[model samples]
Target chain A: MRHFVFSLFTLLLACGAQAELRVFATVPEWAALARELGGDRVKVYSATSAFQDPHRIEAKPSLLAQARQANLVVAAGAELEVGWLPLVLRDSGNAAIQPGRPGYFEAAACVDRLEVPSVVDRAHGDVHAAGNPHIHLDPHRVQKVAEALAARLAEVDAPNAATYQANLKAFSGKWQAAIARWEREGAPLKGVGVLVHHASFTYLTHWLGMKELGTLEPKPGIEPTSGQLSGLLARQQAAPARMVLRTAYNPEGPSQWIAGKSGTPAVLLPYTVGGTPAAKDLVGLFDDTLQRLLQAVR
Target chain B: MQKRIAMAAMLAATFGAQAADHSELAAIRAQIDDMKRAYEQRIAALEQKLAQAESRPAAKPAPATVQSERTDSRRPAAGPASGFNPEVSLILQGQYKNMKDVPERGITGFWPAGGHDHGEGAIEGISKRGFSVDHTELVLAANIDPYWRGQAIIAAIDGTAEVEEAWFQSLGLGHGIGLKGGRFRSGIGYLNEQHPHMWDFADAPLMYRALFGNHGSYTNDGVQLKWLAPTDTFIELGAEMGRGANFPGTDRNKNGSGAAAVFAHVGGEVGVSNSWRAGVSYLTTQAKSRAAHFAGTVDDEVEGLFDGRSQNFIADLVWKWAPNGNPKYQNFKFQTEYFQRREKGDLTCATPEGAAATVACDGMLSAYRTRQSGWYAQGVYQFTPNWRAGLRYEQLDSGRRDFGDNAAYLVVDSYRPKKASAMIDYSWSEFSRVRLQYAQDKSMFGITDNQVTVQYIMSLGAHGAHKF
Candidate 1:
């Protein structure tokens, strides 16, 4: 019995030493970022897919289980995950990943946010008080988040600090070059007028200098009513936008209806990694987005 | 001859002074030139260093330009004055119920253990007829500190208020361990811990009504400890000890804990679209002089008192499915729970004063033992974003009753009680919902009550997220 117990303990120790770190990401974009930075040293799990709405994901048992074993929690904070992340963290019983700990990383905190409401009220329909959290759309913002996340990884796993830093430097080099290329290629998109299904493309539009004419939804989270759709249609007739923009997860009904009525094309942009078949990683996401936008205009 | 020599000396002296002054002026000019050259070289070096510093960042213009642009547009919004205040929410609920007016309603084949008074036409404290305000709840929650969080839920009904739950939980206990203390709903069964406002139906399940009195569920002052295993699949073990002052067990003035319970749950996902959980629990408590009522021969009422130990076991299961794990469009959940209880001790039966002499008037105490069980199954489906429908069925069994000497006077029916309910609800948003429900309750022997209900629940203030 003593020998068996000792062997069991050794087995557990071996399992523990196998994985350098366990990362729990609240969204696919952050999960992709963590994998890029951590490389082969970390086991990462994403709580929600690219197609799921981060604002409404349930704190399911599987998520709680993943959180329980996580050494670090990477989130797209700024209240983007306010609905479920807190509950999952509280119930996880893993003290290392608590809000104030070194193991907790929020990418939204690393970048400047847009659409900050002056007045915080639900009357405006589910507005985030900390500003828009869709910072991953901009390559520059993604680079900033990557730098901070690499630093966070080093803080939690000090022995691998140099490796994390090397990884960050490599990622930044590739990302910066990509940004330069995209900026040059997307020059024609400057000042292009567009309509969006939701306010989910603030960073993307801001990056490419595109003009947002209107949104389908009357507010942030409310579904578009027919009256609101008609109002947008009338506005489109007066000053037609070049195209209507929506993410892959957004319903196709409203955008299609408006596009058919207003002769402008409807463009479906991959909002994150794996949002489209071509968008399998971070770079592919922007590539597909730009390609679709450019196709639409042509 | 002396005058001529002095004039020559004076001329020589003047010539010497002019030459020395010329050399000194040339030397001063050279010194000024050297100083100008040194200053020019230093300025050039400093400018070179400045250009190098500036060009270093310019090489990576993406982050620099984006950073500057971000700072240019970054307008830090001022948060509300009550940012640090605890989250407070109020739930307003009211319902209109229609049912048969029955006097002295009780479930047949089941020993009445002080549950809701069905005879008074109240189902889970909701009035049976006409319109009435249901229970309204006010909830406040906040993190007390780095190590603890506190929450309080106050329920108000008919101008009176009561603290339904006030508990503090340990926040920083590592190693997958959690501790909670104070008055809380016991974490014994899946449905036990959920507040009535979160229930799918307007009323409590028949099994819960039979097990716990009008309260429908058990809440007591207690402390609980839970541990979650570090595994791929979800597994949790919990134990609780509390003052058993409600339902099935009478409040005793003893010092130590009057009840203890332990439970374990395991769950996992089948695929991206489905998940399931199963749990089992056991509870034990003591009852002293628990009061109950039963029918007697020829339209007579007998009062029965029981003193004994009660032990109950519960098993529960739940399954949920969504399209690609996105529940915003459509989802379905099915859950079921079964409960079995055993009680052993003594029972006494007696007749009320001014009543004619009847068999119950013998007033005899006898050794009593019984085993009773019940189960309920429910399913709720969300066909669209704003609409949902649900169906529920429940039944109770009175397995055995050994009343001993009191059995001759007390009445025992060989009937089983069951109920079926169907409901549909609409939610314009997450904060408000209106529901319509109909139920056929054959819980009482020889009586089948068809009930209809319309209820509305509206939430104000902080939005609370639901947990699965």
Candidate 2:
């Protein structure tokens, strides 16, 4: 009889162990952020990897299954996942993670957005109509998002409120210190000129005060016409940028071609957490990015 | 005795002194207990204070979740989450076709596929020549309320218009239960639910055209209930009830219950790069005087009716591969579907004079019991972000039949029909594509045609992402 009671007690604990909150994030950056905020109290899954374009993510069954059981959903929003996220949420059959619920957290909503367009034109290749949604690259913005996510995790899984609070306290202390160090190291990038593959780095450029020398795409999502490529080539001959920036996810052919012909160095930034081997987490993401920019300068 | 009494008195005096030391030890023990009680009281008070502090957080009303959505200037001013602004999008589709001229053009032995006409794509014998606008689809979708979301699609084909799909589905059903109602595509086969524009090739597979009347699977007024099992592997089961007003159904122009279907699917990932899915489905329906027969093939063919009960069975499988689960640069998808249909009823036939039959008979009846089956397999590979190529092979068999002396009605080699097609396409973006395709079609017995099609699909406004 005693053995039976002990076995039943063990079973109860095993069931409780599987009760951790499930988090479904649209990008790896948000997944890393949730891991820091939720600690061991949650199991977080990212729909897209660091080496994939977030704007054109395909909806897979595994992703839908995650959404169906997710207690919280963190996304970049502002139409960053406008192509896929809505459908996934609708099909997930899980109402807890739907938009407008406390369980839904959009990172772009946590920060001051950049380049709010005065007009909307989808045909011109400016895909995101609600301004740019790639706001995760800015450390200050990421800190703000992390604070919101921590509070959301507490609200969604109230039983673990204390755990979330402790994790938040620890993360904020370390993240703030890291931010200050990054600002000091990135000081040299303040007026450095750069050409980009797309407008994906507007937040990075704004935060570091880097000069934007236009983009190789010419128009946002459209392939550059020969005329547009030649125009960029001719302009580069006159006033070349110090660095041509492209994320690991974006195709490298165009940026490398421009770099080769225009005599500029092309630098691949860790656009999100785990985009490169060195960027295994949120802090490493920024450290690697800043280090690359500084290296290009040297 | 007096001396002993004096010694006893002295012993008593010593015992009294030791008793005094024992009293001092008891007093020390009491003092220690009093200190422990005092410390316990202090700790309790501190714990109470800590609990109160934790219970009452700083009165900062958490950053209103509403403020996050309002920050985006793109949203309509002051219109929150449920503001009735539905997403609207327009699709423009056009195509050019070139095929060899033949004395007759028709898919030979498709019996019940002559009636329903719903979406895009050509049927067996209706292939056109030259340039034409195939279809322009208009789509509108939005969440109706917290519990429901609705979508409507209208297709404009040639000079006619049709509602391809219009349905409202439950949004709040958790644990994988889904409820959908209204006119929509039935999810019976792997490719049955996808629209023509989403197909890898410009033309429908020969098997699909023979079974679904050319535009892939036909849509119907219906309601569906689906459940996804709570397991690690992807398992789904669904049942649907629809008004059988179209081909193979012969709604008989009546409104009563006409058709019903049930399906089951299971899928799981093999590793980091490979994923696979397989499904089995069954559909049963009754057709009252269903209209059918070949039209203007070799001669003016006549229209006939098959009044009976029909049943169809479909088995399908799909396998996808992408290294490390990243398919942007390269991926391969192989899919195949096999279907068998059984019909039992009375079929009425006519003479070669067709609708103009004068003497040979206006009312010719034959006991009809027929079984037909077909299968198609296709593979698509995306070698680059913008370039892809696909190849497909299809075959159909006109199954065992007893026509009751109407041997003249049997057309072509009833046992076999085969077709092979290959295509390559380039996508400008996720929303736009141009494709070139060629095929050798022998759906008709002893007749072959080499066909070529150049097609383009362009989208404007909002387009939702496709599901895999």
Candidate 3:
């Protein structure tokens, strides 16, 4: 019995040593970013798929199992995961990735957020007091988060610090070049008035200089009513938007209805990595988004 | 700067060509305003980044040095003003129940367990014939420190308040070990740990009512220890020691623990949509002089007292499925649990002091023993975002009863008990729900009750996520 116990302990230690860093990301975009920074030195897992709403994901047992062995947990914090992340962290029983620890990294904390509400009230529907958490759409904010994530990786897995830094440098250089090209190619999209299904596209429109006409839903998380849809239609007929924008996961009914009534195009943009077939990575996400928007305008 | 000046020059040339178009001019002005706001935001972001960088430590240190610094700075020096303020939430619940007015209610084929009974005008356990307040709970939770987290749930039934749960859990216990102490719901079965508000139906299963009395759950003051295995699949083992002061056990004034329990659970996901968990548990306790009231065959009330050892074995399973791992619109969950109990002890049955004894007790103590078992199965489906429907069926068997030498006075029944319930609930938001439930309850051997209940539950403060 003693020998068996000793062998079991040794086996657990060997398993722990195999993975230099186990990263659990609450969203796919963060998982993609972690993979880019920790190349070969880290094992990354995404708790939610690109086709799932981040705000409403359940704290399933599968996620808890992943969190139990994770050396780092990446989340779009600022209350984006307020509903489920706390429960996952509390129940994981893994001390390494609890809040305020070195292993826990929040992407939104690394950048300035938009749409911060001064008066926090549910009367305005489900409003995040810490501002909009869709910071990944802005490539600049993604770059900022990359720097912080790289630093965090180095802190947790010091043996791979040099590798992490080198990977960060290479990723940043390529990403900056891609951003420049996208900006130049997307100049035609400047000052284009668009209607969005939700405020999820706030950072994206802000980056590309698109004007947001209105939202389909009257509030942040409330479903759109027929009365509200007709109101938006009336406003659209008076000052027509060029297109209606929605993510791949959003319900297509409202956007299609408005687009049909206004005689405009309804565009589906890939909100994250793997959201669409062409959006297989970070660069492809923006490329596909720009391509879809350009197609709509043409 | 040069690009802006050139754009302004181009706009001026356009204006010179189409000066008569007022709508075009207004649109150009709006575009210019948008550009101005965008630039201002960009500058502000850059300034904020600069400030952050300036505030960071200047020296680039090695990883070892950084680790030491982080260890030293485990707790934040300055917390938010409301950091000490706990997350407080209140659940408001009321229900209108329509059923027969049975003055005294008890499941027929089961031994009467001891727990909280209804307060005031509640003649039929938790509900009456008309409108009544259900269990309204006020919960407060917060991280006590770097090493501990604490929570308290106070429940108000009718006009009286009771502490439902108050516990502190260790937050920094590594290696998948967790420690908790205080009064808490026993983690014996899947449904036992969840509060009534989280139940899919308005009422609990008949099996629970038989085992833990009308309260439908077992709570005790105890210390619990749990260990989670480090594996891809979820495996957890837990053990608890508690003061056995509630149903199926009695408060035997002793120095050590009177009740002990151990449980193990295994779970995993199948493909991308379905997940399942299965668990088995065992509990043992000692009861000294437990009191119970039962109706005799002649409608006379009989008093029974028991002193003995009781043991329970339970098995539970839950399975859930959502399309593409997204449950925003549709999902389904099926859960089932089975409970078997065995008890051996000396039982004394007699009439109350003021009542006449239809059956003579003769002051005789009989060596009585019994083995009983119960099981329930339920399923809930959410077809839309705001609507859900559920159905549950439960049955109990009074397997064997032996009242040696006192069989005439302590009568045993051969009848089995069962109930079937169906419910539909709609939620306008995550914090509010209204449910309509109907049940055909035959748990009380001779009576088959058709019951209807309409319940409304509203949460007034902090929103809590339900555990899977």
Candidate 3 per-residue lDDT, tens place, B330-425, comes to 899999999999999988776665575444664568897989999999999999878999999999998987777666665578668989999999
DockQ of each candidate relative to the true complex: 0.22, 0.12, 0.19
lDDT of 2 by residue, A1-298 (tens): 9999999999999988778998888999999999999887889888888877777666666677678778889888777887678878887777777776777777776664555443456666755544578888877778778777888888889988999989999999999898778888888888777988888888788678787787888678765556776787788767768988898877788878877887789899988898889999999999999999999999
Candidate number that wins on DockQ, 1 or 2: 1
Error of 2 at B66 (Å): 13
Better of 2 and 3 by TM-score: 3
Number of backbone collisions per candidate: 4, 0, 0
Candidate 2 Cα misplacement greater than 4 A, ranges: A1-6, A224-227, B1-68, B71-83, B101-105, B116-126, B253-256, B294-303, B350-365, B405-413
The positional error of residue B368 in candidate 2, measured at the CA in angstroms, is 2.2
Reference contacts recovered by each candidate, as fractions? Answer: 0.35, 0.22, 0.34
TM-score of every candidate's chain A = 0.95, 0.95, 0.95
- For model 2, the docking class works out as incorrect
In candidate 3 the C-alpha lDDT for residue B349 amounts to 72
Tell me the tens digit of each residue's lDDT in model 3 across A23-125: 9999999999999999989999999888888888887888888898999999888678878888888778899988778878888777666665545677887
Candidate 1 residue-wise lDDT, B1-468, digit = tens: 898899999999998999899899899999998897677445544543342233221123332211232232111121332356888989998899898887666677876755334355344357447788877899999889878989999998866799999999988998999899999988888888887778999988877777775567888789999998999899999999999887788898899998899999899899888988899999888888787776665337777778999898999999999888877768999999999989999987766544666543456799989998999999999997779999999999988888887776678777789999999999876777999999999998889999999999988877666667
Worst 10 residues of 3 chain B by lDDT: B58-67
The whole-model C-alpha lDDT of candidate 2 against the native structure comes to 0.77
Best by DockQ: 1
Lowest lDDT block of 10, candidate 1 chain A:
A111-120
